[model samples]
Target: MSTRGKNHSEWDSISTLYHTVVGQLTIPIAAGLVDWVHETVPLNGPGANAMDNGCGTGIVCSLLKSNYPTLPVLATDFSSAMIDEVLRNAEESGWKHFQARVLDSRNLDSVETESVTHLFTTFMICLAPDPDQIVSEMHRVLQQNGILGLAVWARPNFGFFEAAWIEACHELDPTYEAPTLMDPEWIEPENVRRGLAKAGFKSVEIKAEQQSWDWENVNAVSTYFFDGHNPGNTKWHDSWTERGQSIDKVRPLFERKLEEAYGQSDGSLKGPVPFCLAIARK
Candidate 1:
């Protein structure tokens, strides 16, 4: 088990703040992955359906609805709060023939074998405690020749922000130690390919590249991260608070560190975060 404890549980508390955290980066890529699925997979037809196994707040479902209004979409996430968000979206969007489930991607016991025509999981499998099992479950659920579109970070894309935050934490309390956001080997394309092959994916294609993102200014970027209740952000807050330090006191220092490294001419933050999208077939 990860020493960070159950990250999934942390995700539950930040369901509302999730969109503000990584939605800007993941949603566009999700759109692209959905479009990519459309090239081969039928969105709507008899026995034709799609599932977003690790759907966070149903970004993929919302996009799928826009593309195929009548498509049978199943949005599943480990967090009930996230499933609730999907349900809320369905209610507001008037989605038809859609379903949402609070299910872990690792063990999709509720999903049946050869059930979905396409499985799309953006920025999900990488964080899985057992990606091989997650991929195995995905393979089991997908119909013959079904495609898996998996998006993950090429590596943690925190830029200079993490180091600066750690610096501030150390200054506040010398006992501070930064956490590892991800495993190094898991991000390797070769390892991903090997894992997929083990999961019975015969044809696997992996692409690693930088995806550009924008911000009005660096403060906008900082505000989204610092001025939020995301688990990732909350940990820092908890650390700062437990150390008997006002969180506000460290903001200026962190801001200066960010501005020095990432600030643009117009005071905007940097862009073009790295990510990998693996398209595999069973």
Candidate 2:
């Protein structure tokens, strides 16, 4: 698996737009994670050591702080651009407990082995080329009996922004292959559990928690696509144009599908999509 760096600058360029798209989706996901933490580990009581891997813009960091006020967190990402955004958000939000750093998961040098009390990451495992290496690094860094919490998009069931994008892709390129940005290897519960066990973790449990990208209409989803914060804009734009499809043509098709699948009486899009979240212990 390639450890090639992510294009964080493109995401940074559209940070505000990205934040808008994520703001709604994040709260439910965080709420679900909070429930999972309560079930698996104690969020309060003692001073726990926690790390939010890929702490982009510090959304999860902020959520962790709200849930575990006494927890000392080390928030890290492979991209310095992401780290900068995390720092900025932390400063602006008055989050004083987190220490932000740029560190690749394949090789974590700054943190000592077996030091972290809990490892938390959301929507990140799928981005790695070698998730096993990342799991191993987590295993090395987390204390014995420490917990690992992760959240990932489940295969789209019912309706979702991702399904709308797929519908648009089919309209543009019939044979268009979705890139493995969220690599499926990490998406599967079996694969995740196996990797965690291989990395010396035990008592892994997985669950599906439904969530969604809510928008007024499909145009909002299309706007999110072109915003360039996601790999959709950075890696997929050229392929879309090469196939002779413009955003103008594709946008309406996606909107129509979304409307057909999940339209309101007033013609807006609303509802929660499904996601799979995993919790494991070392």
Candidate achieving the largest lDDT:
1
lDDT of 2 by residue, 152-212 (tens): 7655222365566677779767887655446666766777677777878889888866775
**Regions more than 4 Å wrong, model 2:** 1-10, 156-159, 169-173
Best by TM-score: 2
Q: State model 2's lDDT.
A: 0.71
Which pairs of residues clash in candidate 1, taking residues 3 or more apart in a chain or in different chains?
A: 218-268
lDDT of 1 at 199: 86
TM-score of each: 0.85, 0.86
lDDT of 1: 0.75
Clashes of 1: 1
> Could you tell me the TM-score of candidate 2?
0.86
lDDT tens digits, residue span 1-282, model 1: 001112356678668877766777778888877776676565665677888888888888899988898888888888777887778878888999888877778888888999888888887776657777888899999988888888777665234357678776677677866665655545668877887888898788887766766767767767866876666567667767876888788887777776776768976777567777777888
